[model samples]
Target: MKNVTVVGLGKIGLPLAAIFANCGHFHVYGADINKLVVDQVNQGISHVNNEPGLDELVAKAHQKKSLEATINTAEAVSKSDIVVVIVPVLTRENGQINYQYIDSAVEEIAKGIKMGTLVTFETTLPAGDTRNRFGKTIEKISGLTMGKDFFLSYSPERVYSNRIIKDLSSYPKVVSGYNKRSLELATDFYKKGLNCEILQVSTLESAEFTKVAECVYRDVNIALANELAIYANNLDINIMEVIKAANSEPYSNIHLPGVGVGGHCIPVYPYFFINNGMHEGLTTLSRKINDSMAEYAVELIEEIIGSLKDKTILILGLSFRGNVKEPTKSSTLLLIEALKERETTVCVDDPLFNPDEISKYGVIPFSNQLADQIDAIILQAYHDEYQKIDFSVFENCSLILDGRNVLNQREIENLGMKYLGIGIK
Candidate 1:
């Protein structure tokens, strides 16, 4: 069995640690800055929200002595032959790439790592960051040559929070190394942990670009759907009908529109690409369009909520996407903030979140029995709980705004509820 250390205990890092630990081929040590997180992991408890079998895995690994978690970076690094960094690269308010966390992690790993260690980064960053920012720092700190003395690589984490358990093995892994040796090392290690196929790229930047491009492509397409949804509203046309007809051609693929885009990668990765290009004279129209979706959604929501200022409004779903506890850049929260600012009384419901937990948002928790009390409702996620909803449950709801087109317009409107759906009449 190989020895492995994973830095960061957040969404991407925790599951990755479990995969290696469960593989029966790795002695894993997980390191995180949070003491509570470390304690939980050591007890075989997972703090990653909505992750199944995680607590059991943690308990099992800890009991087997194959896995452990610690706050001491030096101790974990001292025992590990391979290190995986899964930190986040958040876009700053000024549209700049924040490399502070990444730089800090690199410095820590440099201090703790031994010679001939393999370091693989799973953080989303601009192309050339590993070589320019991390590579030089490691070289300076450890005074070791990267390709010869040690190995460095980049691999994007493709697991979405809701589908992480299934997707970890179902989706193809995209990987690249600083050099051929580094690439081979990562490919072999991942193949052991995952049931999925690994696609190797020549350069670290290629691997990084592949992930960023994938998310950006989705963002641009969703923005197009959002923009078209507005036009459909103006034309009094059911955009869903038109889109279904267009999709029947088999060549024209159209994405569904929502209140706005959410989740970590789609909203953040494009900034890394766009900001990096600013230094090289690049202006991207797609990024701008996607970024403006929140503002557009806010405006649309304002117009809808204007008439119901004094009425209680129910917003169903809080996560960035449906069925996940990840609230990073969730458009639903954005809509909540906008609605709160307009002095609208908001009642929120999500199967994944507790009412007491979200009480500070000046909203009440909506239960199955309470959905009928609201004057208006906003369906942000098409979670299964909401999908199987009976139209009679919302008989008292005067208005229903479906960001995800969750409700059937014919049924909902026929029940005396006015429906405003994305690309649907």
Candidate 2:
């Protein structure tokens, strides 16, 4: 079996390592800086929550002795024939790509990469970064020529959190390489390892641009939906109904409008494209529109309930998306900040997070006893747990803001609470 090293071991990385190991063609080593994660993986446990098949996959890989985890990334790379780097590349507040994490990963790989080793980056990057920045770093540090001594490829990860395993098998994996030989190696490896269909692009830049373009399309479309939602509210029409009806036509593919768009992918990837000196107008404006939505929700609350200065508000679901624990780029963070600025008392609840964990954000952890003090409620995330929530417990709540537009209006109104939803009249 060929030895394969997978770096980062995050939500995506861990699953990827496990998948590689279970494929029966490779032995996988997972490397990460976090000791807790390394320990968990070595012990055949999964630290990532809400992933359906990950725990089983990790356990199976461990039991089969096909997978190992370590904090020493370079050591793992040194023993591997193929190295896959799946680290994060975040964007700063100014919308500039922060290359620190991915740069660090590449530097470590450079320290251990040997001649004839295949190196592939699955981290989403600004287009051409695979060849320009990271490939050059490897060449400079390792003193090896790309496409000669070492093979290089780029394939962006295209899976969601809860259904990563399924998505991996379902979606056609996009693959690209530095040269013809590198492309052939990458295509063969993924074919044998993943057993999934591959869509090979002509160049590394094309593969990188594909992922960013997907994100940009969603961001811009969601911004359009948000704008239309606001306009619908002014016209006393329900935007949700209009969207459902319009989407029935073959070409109308409007995404649902919410209080705001959140999550790691949609909220951050646009900045990668924007900072790359591409068309800055639409992407920049979409980001501003989505970012302003948290403040918009706060304004809606104040307009309905009159001055949120002293009112106690409770926000349901702290995670960026429903049913997932990650809070990266969550709109709830922005909402909390906006509410606190107005001197409003804020409380948060999420089924995925404990009370102590919720308290870390400097907000009250929601409990039944605190319900009486709540002046309003906002459904920021439509977690499955909230579907059956009894609305009557918040006896003093005068209004319920359905930020996700998923709550039952009739049921909330029956409790003598005024129901306000985004773009619902």
Name the best candidate (by TM-score). 2
Give one clash count per candidate, in the order shown.
2, 0
**TM-score, cand. 1 vs. native:** 0.90
Provide the TM-score for each candidate, comma-separated.
Answer: 0.90, 0.98
lDDT of 1 by residue, 1-425 (tens): 88999999888788889888988889999988889999988888888876776667777788898888998876788678899998777877676777777678778888888888989888887888877788888889989999888899998887777557678888888989998899988998889877679999999989888888888778777777777877897898888887788889978888877777777788788777777644342225655555565455545655655654666778888777777776677777777776776677778888888888667566788877776677787887667788787767765677778878767888787888777876565
The C-alpha RMSD in Å for every predicted model, in order, reads 2.8, 1.1
**Residue 281 in candidate 2, Cα distance off native in Å:** 1.2
Clashing pairs in 1: 44-58, 44-59
Tell me the RMSD of model 1 versus the true structure.
Answer: 2.8
lDDT value, residue 196 of candidate 2: 94
- By lDDT, the best candidate is 2
Alpha-carbon deviation at 98 in model 1, angstroms: 2.7
Runs with alpha carbons beyond 4 Å of true place in candidate 2: none
In candidate 1, stretches whose alpha carbon ends up further than 4 angstroms from where it belongs are 52-56, 278-308, 362-373, 390-396
lDDT of each: 0.79, 0.91
